[model samples]
Target: MTENDKPAEAHEQDGTQLARENWERYQYCVSRGHRDYTRLASRLEGFYLGGGEQWSREDLEILHEQGRPAYEFNEVMPAINAAVGYQIHNRMDIAFRPRGGDATKELAEVRTKVAKQIADNCRLHWKETEVFGDGMIQQRGFFDVRMGYDDAVLGELSISVLDPLDVMPDPDAKSYDPKDWADVTVSKWLTLDEIEGQYGKDARLRAEGARALGDEDFGEGDDDGTSRNKFGWQDTGRYDAEYAGGGPRRLRVIDRQKRVLSQMQVAIFPGGDVRQLAGDEKPEVLEQLRANGAFITRRMMKRVRWIVSTCDALLHDTWSPYDRFTVVPFFPYFRRGKTRGMVDNAVGPQEALNKAVSQYVHIINTTANSGWAVEQDSLTNMTTEQLEEFGASTGLVVEYATGKRPPQKIQPNQVPAGVDRIIDRAAGTLKEVTVPDAMRGTQGPETSGIAIQSKQFAAQQGLAVPLDNLARTRAMVADWIDYAITKYYDSERVFRITKTDPLSGKEVEEELTINQWVPESGGYLNDMTSGEYDVVVTEQPMQVTFENGQFQQAMEMRGAGVRVPDSVVIRHSNLTDKHEIIQQMEAASATPPDPLAEAEAVLAQARARLAEAQAERARAEAVNKSIEGMFSSAQTATLVAQNPAIATAADGMWKSAGGIDKDAAPAIPSIDAPAVAPPEQNTNPLTPANPSVGMNAGIEGGQP
Candidate 1:
């Protein structure tokens, strides 16, 4: 058939229409983003980099005409950098935890190691810092994660930070997360060779043809002024010499990911997830499933699909392997479906500060010295320039016209009373609206150490939103890496994991292999694909200053008898060779003891035993003495009480010795005396004696 006689296929037409629609959609998104975010983000980034023009164009032009310097002291940069450095120094670590049965615990550990390995291999920290800086300066940041291949044999997960300008999400979407947006488009300029290498020769040819077409709608080879203005491009002659000036054409490649819900015929495996089936394969798969008595069903499900296209051609179209888009976004201050950033808060005050400073300098420059007030053309001996230049020189003579009054010296006006105060106020406001002095590591006005620490802590707390957003982004990225591992590392693969050994204070490298099927267990050991996992992000401060503080605190605790181990204290130190030091300490401990020291130790033990024996003997002696004292007191009491009995036995001897001292003795009562009971007497000792008791009984009348 002739070249024009062949009919266009329906599939080609559909692809072309889809490509056009996608291009249109991308254009609309770009337009909206430029209006809503990109322009402002560009300005904010300028502020961060110290390039944001504080004065208006007209004002700047007037200042330039007047030979006045438009000064800009970048307060925004210091605040933003302080915040970014805070995150970098106090880095966050990603950890994986088993969310399924206990069987998944080991696998989750392996996943954690693998995740860390991925982050290390990809330099995720640096990228994270860039993303964080962008988010703080602008309103959002993005992380793109995907699997890359090494030597086309081994797969590795890669993470990179995406420039906010390169990413365009659905502006009308009611969420700030890119994954939750209805669609997200990432654009980049690629050379033809790069295009061929990535998308294939057909794509390169199509892109080349589109560039040759030079259609503005195709977004290729067309340098609309928007790119230059939005990105603040200078006259670099790149477009004149390279792009449309006969050099190689660079095409803008768009990767658009969209979420869609569709109805599909799916085969439901026994106790498994449903798998979608194509129209042509549905009947055969159904028959096979029916033969096996498997379940079948139809359902509507949401799926993410990626479409790669240029302006005029579709390069690739496939369903995303991940559950969500690969690009994750972090918006620090999202409210009402929009975003605000630290720079936004500081811009007003920063501009004011700059203006105040600039005006102060300008006033000083203009009024630092006295000027001469003279009539027009009053100088006679010298020109105005020469006269003014030599006026400040010593021993210079000034000659004015004889008719004109001699030039009068006009003193400059004093600077306004509150000019310094205005500058200080503006500067303070800038700091207050953004990072505080405490956050910048500056000493505050508080005299108490505790007050200073509390102020610093409060300042850090002020950044909780951004820091928490960063942690959330990290957790999300961890999940992405985990999913990627499960999808890509489904074969026996060996990788090394490095970790700090807590006991030895050294980094230990371990080589692990996963996904090896075992017939005995009927499953793969360390299988990442088998179970669900949860991601947790924890802060691990990497700054030496923080480590030093921790070390000092640990030492103080140890001094206070807190029982903190020496090895742990050393681990908190910032010494680069602390592990070596620990090793040396351990070696010293393990060495054989000195003979003399051993002998001394033995003698010390013997002395302790002897002291204990002596203590025991002393206690026994004390108990015996106590018993003897009690017996002696009892014996004395018995001897004293027996005096009455002894006196009764010696009655005859006493009578002979005293000659019966009967005259001095009182009359005794006889046995024949009246048996009358003695009258009741008062028992109280203090009462008067009852002298009538014995006389009334009449017992004293008869003596024995």
Candidate 2:
């Protein structure tokens, strides 16, 4: 046989054998992984919902056989609920960051906004939280990202959480990302009309025929516990006797997805232009490309493909447009090549707590009140029956033989002190194993806010791995969404998202479009298909607290004269009207200052300076006048000393005006000149302080 003919012969194999092989592999996978995990996960979910022992009929029977009541004192629910609540309380958002060229950065912003709008439209937060809660309770969670047209020309991106039991991944594969798995199978129960609507009438007819073949030929589904928990009792019988038309005829439709090797041709031209051909080109197309100076090269790659089949027939086969598996699996606590949940450790203690509390209640019920021990001869108006009925009544009168010792009271049986302690310890152990008191917001009355915050932070740190796992999964989902955007959104489309603007702190509707034609570049602007983005998950467990702290810090900086921007301060504030407030601030900034007011302020300052200068000048002139008078007196004294007649006349004038009194004041120096005078007799106030001073000293000192 020729090598190329082998695939044709393989494809010619009987449909029944192919179906058998696929179904058997699916069964094998279910046996090895899905079935056992489903059972455990279901029980864990029961425990989380306060019904842990509800389906354990054998255990309840055993307890009843032992004369104990069957009860479920659910201490597990609180811890699990608290853990789930913690995720809900601290909401997170997914962001896309550019990892390529400058164009990628611009596209990333538009994509980020588009992603947020998609998330809001699909209510992604609720789905994410649901998946997280399931993972915490059941050890695994899944998300499905896909494009849906919904009867429109343009496709929309959607994300949904899938039930863990409904998805069967490769049992031996150990990877956090689903794209790395060897294969995965997803099963759904759909009515014939539903299947026909999705896969066409021909496919639906074949699936219906397969359903009629019974377990011997088509094989029975191993979905006893799993499907019942999720889909609730799917009737897989050939025909429903209770219904007139077989009750819509539901069938198990399995989509087995895997990657297959494929080849693509890359054509390189002389002008450095390259194009990829998907190996389906005609001879003429290749010859034309060769004539255009193109070098053709082939490269082998793996591409995602999935098959739709029932137990007896292969319905369809197709390749996925997206780069990887659409379903993303998140294992919060993957260890030792296996995935386990936070609830795993707490399950044992939780059961013990339930049993302990149940047993304690039984003890109280059986031994709470005491019975009487009475003398037989002691009889009054009351018989033994009456005494049994009324003996415990208050103010009861019992007439007995006078000396018959009063009926003695029997001691009541007490529940053992250790039972209470056991229940408490089991409950505490359950909490410790799962969430702990700190995470549950338990604290002493005297606990300071700082101390409480510290404890809460420590508790959060303990669960950081799981939170990180969730974040990583979200990043993968974001990447998938980005891929869908590039692949499906080839035309300009508006994405209207309602969000709180980071700058304004207000809920506003934002619209953005991608792949719009740009005449300047002669190509599309914001070409989403041409760039790469890295997904960054922004967790906001304390968004309010963070924003409040930022706002306070900004205000303080402004108070300290730090020139902080009003826009920045407004952005961090929590006011609902911040958009309006910001708008006012921007408008005020854009408006010009009043020129007349500025001039008036400058003039006021100038006038104050002028008054100060005038006052300074007047003080200087008064001092100058006093100094001139002193200098004139000294000059006159110098002239008088040169002529004795003037000195004698001045002395007479001084004496006549009573300028000098010998008894009260020292005698003034005489104007009459002497060749030399005694120093003690020199009483003139204007005399040079230093005998050797220069004659021009006064003039020089008074020059300015």
Candidate 3:
């Protein structure tokens, strides 16, 4: 059968009218985005880089001639963007607060660990979102966070931020002030790839690819099986030649434009959450699970991708990918004096100031260049061509000497009065809208302490609305991270766990099974899923810590008479990462010092001293007994013969009294006392006092 005779099936999409219908809807969303962002992108870039089409032609010429202008003194918008960006980048703190049944401490801690790990990994990504979002929040006045899971492809969960310009809600929408999207949020991005990758290698994608080829040039030669008319016009490739602009054309009329649209619509159902339901009420709610569906379509040029997918969201069981994800929309400086994000607060003042500065620069250059009119008399020597050259190069005009005039300055609005004033006034307006002068470090010395503080507070207050939103964003991101890990990161991961090792107290890194950390599971991390969780975006208060950190703080508190544990101190110290070691230190410090143990230590020393004293006493006693036996006779004689002052009666047998004191005392033994005559009576017969050298030794060490 001929190509047309083969019916619609011979073409692409396998005859599905549904795909075509979806393509039409996607086209509308994409067109809306293009319309909204067409001017916005260029405007934001103009502010950032200092040029835009909105500037007058003269201004553009000046800028084009000058390249980038030095007149972009309006750093206020950037300063605001930077100030908010820095805060979010450095201090977008968050915590995983569990809700519903899984809110126990065990689960909370597990989720916290999971959240921390995820945060550590995705912190940069989140900040990047904030940084770009800050610009949008400052420029367009709103931004959003889009979360997804493709770990099999991305290695971990992903949070792809949708650029504010691409976030198309509704064309008639006055503001991005929806409290919640009871319906849907559509995101559109243009891809330059000729092949639609989202559809894998499907027939529909192949069809779009074929359409994008632009021309069908199958060989006109007879051998290639393509026919050529007498006029030499060749038929388009494989498909039937009956159609115009190539047969089986896949792209739609709107898609014909070079930009292809990748449209993702997250349609949240009204009742995806049933946590509040009674136990018996759950079964009925599950029946409506299909209501929480998400649709992603890849439209290539005029054609629609065949493989459009719709799935039940694991997150919130809604049309959202973030059952665990959060959309932390930032509108730190929302207008309307309300909490919702509005069009750029600085848009008006900023654009005004940019124009004023550019013009001021141009005027200043003009005044400096053409201020003096050249004397025509001086140019008389030069030709017309030479004078023209001089005029063009110097921006000066030639004047005839009219009785002449010397070269004089030409003053436009010679008063020049309002020029500076206008420029200064514009600058002031821009500055007023921004917070670099207050919330940041640029406070002037003349600014009083109270004023400075007030400014800071005002700056903080200004951010309050967005901060609140960011907090929600953080909580959602954190919750989603936990959810992602629980659901996706099931493999063994050596998670850093902080706790005391029962035996030693000090900070340390210990690994806990991811599954065990999560409250409900005693299994591996893979075994667990974040069944349900709640997230809380919090600005973790910057603790006033000394250079010594938590450790120093702990020491100071201790010095101040406040008892604090080393581990607790470590938590505040540089050893925060070593939580386990700190915990161990805390555990060890908690045990009370043992009084009985101290007593035992003292008793052991006392016993050693007593043993030494006994040995000395024994030696003294043995020596005294031996001396009495040896010196009895001579001592007795000496005691009897000497006067009482010089000699007293000796008690030992070896130290008896002199002169027969033995007879008076009932015959103490005296063998050979030299008779009391002359030199011999000096008791030479008495042996030296005996000392029992071996006595103490024998008593102590069994010496002979």
Candidate 4:
């Protein structure tokens, strides 16, 4: 057949089969591959090198064209062959590509070319080999070199070729062959499913073995002499042979004792019995064992023995084990009953003696003859015989009784016999009595001892004089003092009456009364003249004048004659005249002419005029000053003749009708004006009239 029409031959013996198998395997690999290539590349140097590097689009396209075909042929095809086996190869002739069929041959030729081109152009390569060892054999396919860029190598592409029968397992029994195959290939030598089954079987076997060996080593009995085993005692042969029937039996006494010892060993040294001592006196036991060359001391045993001995000694008092024992008395000193004499004899006797002495001293000091008693009211009112009897009764022991006599009695409505004589005598002895004028004028006699006693009694009862009455009395006295001073100052006998000014028609009648000048009047009178005068005029006299549209005034003394100008009348006339003048000026200037715009225009014009005037005046002044200060008379004369005003009025009138009138022009100006001339024709100052001219002639000709 022609090359284009020929059916493509498979590169390997089962290319279609291999393609299908490897395709399935590659799909599984890509699905199952961990996205940890970068990490794996970093750890494993040869497996994958360039990490974190992206494949360019062009590179990816190239790889697609070259690497994809090789992958399909070498890797995917082999995996599919291993998975689907002869089925893919057999079906390929009719299903995908049939020999001598138009469609099948065309596809086959295209695929064949693609595979050949990939194998020729790509950097990757592949190899296949059969591995046979230990009870199994299988075909393995691997890539020679992985597709890569620069120094980076992608993962090795590979697939396994298994026997056709090996791929499918029976549904009834467990799949052991696949499990075994998995055991050979994976890193751990076990698939997840196999590991799970083995783990379950191991657990079941462990349970069974544990049941068979139940409690045999512990032997049932505990350290407290109780059975350790849960299964009770029973005949073994007569019981049914059930799985539950077999169990640990109860332990014996000897075994329990051994268990107790083992427990003690564990408690003492958890590491082991050989590492510890068994005794209460651990240090001493250790020292003894060391001295005796023992590897370890029995500290627990020593402790048990010591406890037993101590208990035995406590039970049986032998050899006086302790030197002395403390004895706490049942009753302490404070709790004991006191002796009878402590309360009744010693303390009671002393207290009684103190009380009796105190009473005796009190009685003796209170007796009448103790000198503390004086002649009180009782003795004073008593008769001489009665006082003597009282002194004897009171045991006063006195030689004689000097008693006070009673006061003489006063009869009602009858003065005493000496009272009249005393009054007459007092009248004649007034010189000796020396009564004060205030006391003599009093209507009642001066209060004696009775009045003073009555007053003192009233005061003790919190009695007080009336405050309002006392205040009124004080006010009356103050008013009297004020009246006396006022009358003294107003007394005409002491002061002469004089009028400050007489009225025009009447004589000065009873001079101005000084009595009118009271503090309420806010003034004092002149003492010598007895005339009323103002002490202060707080209201100052002010005179105001209105003149020339203003008002003013002046103040003068009340008595001093002051003539004030008639400012009100003068100011009225002046204001009238000012108003008239203002009205006239307003009438004259009050024409509204687009006022704001006119003002602006006027202001602008004024500004322009001011600027021009300033410039011209400044220039004229400068010329005048310059010429005046110069050293030439000609300049001065010229400057004088250049005065515009002088020129205008040369003949007493400005004669400038239009241009340069002869009379209006200056005769001798400070700076001369150039002579005026008519314009010349055909002047070309900007061009050279001849080409041969030098620069100097050109410049001179260029000047206008």
User: Top model by TM-score, which number?
Assistant: 1
RMSD of 2: 8.2
Measured on C-alpha atoms, candidate 4 has an lDDT of 0.27
Question: 302-405, model 3: which lDDT tens digit per residue?
Answer: 11122231111000111222331133344444344222222245557666666667666766656553545555464444554565446436445554544755
lDDT per residue (tens digit) for residues 132-220 in model 2 = 98898888889888887774567788788888878888887877777678888887666678778877887776776785333221123
Expressed as tens digits, the lDDT of each residue in 334-429 for candidate 4 is: 112210101111122222333333333434434432222333443444554654446436344433235633322222233236434443443333
Worst 10 residues of 2 by lDDT: 212-221
Query: What TM-scores do the predictions have?
Result: 0.79, 0.76, 0.52, 0.10
Give me candidate 2's TM-score against the actual structure. 0.76
Please state the error at residue 263 of candidate 2 in Å: 3.5
The per-prediction tally of clashing pairs is 0, 0, 40, 26
Which should have the higher TM-score, number 2 or number 3? 2
Model 3 residue 87 CA deviation in Å: 2.5
Ranking by TM-score: 1, 2, 3, 4
Go through the candidates in order and give the C-alpha RMSD of each one to the true structure.
11.0, 8.2, 17.1, 62.2
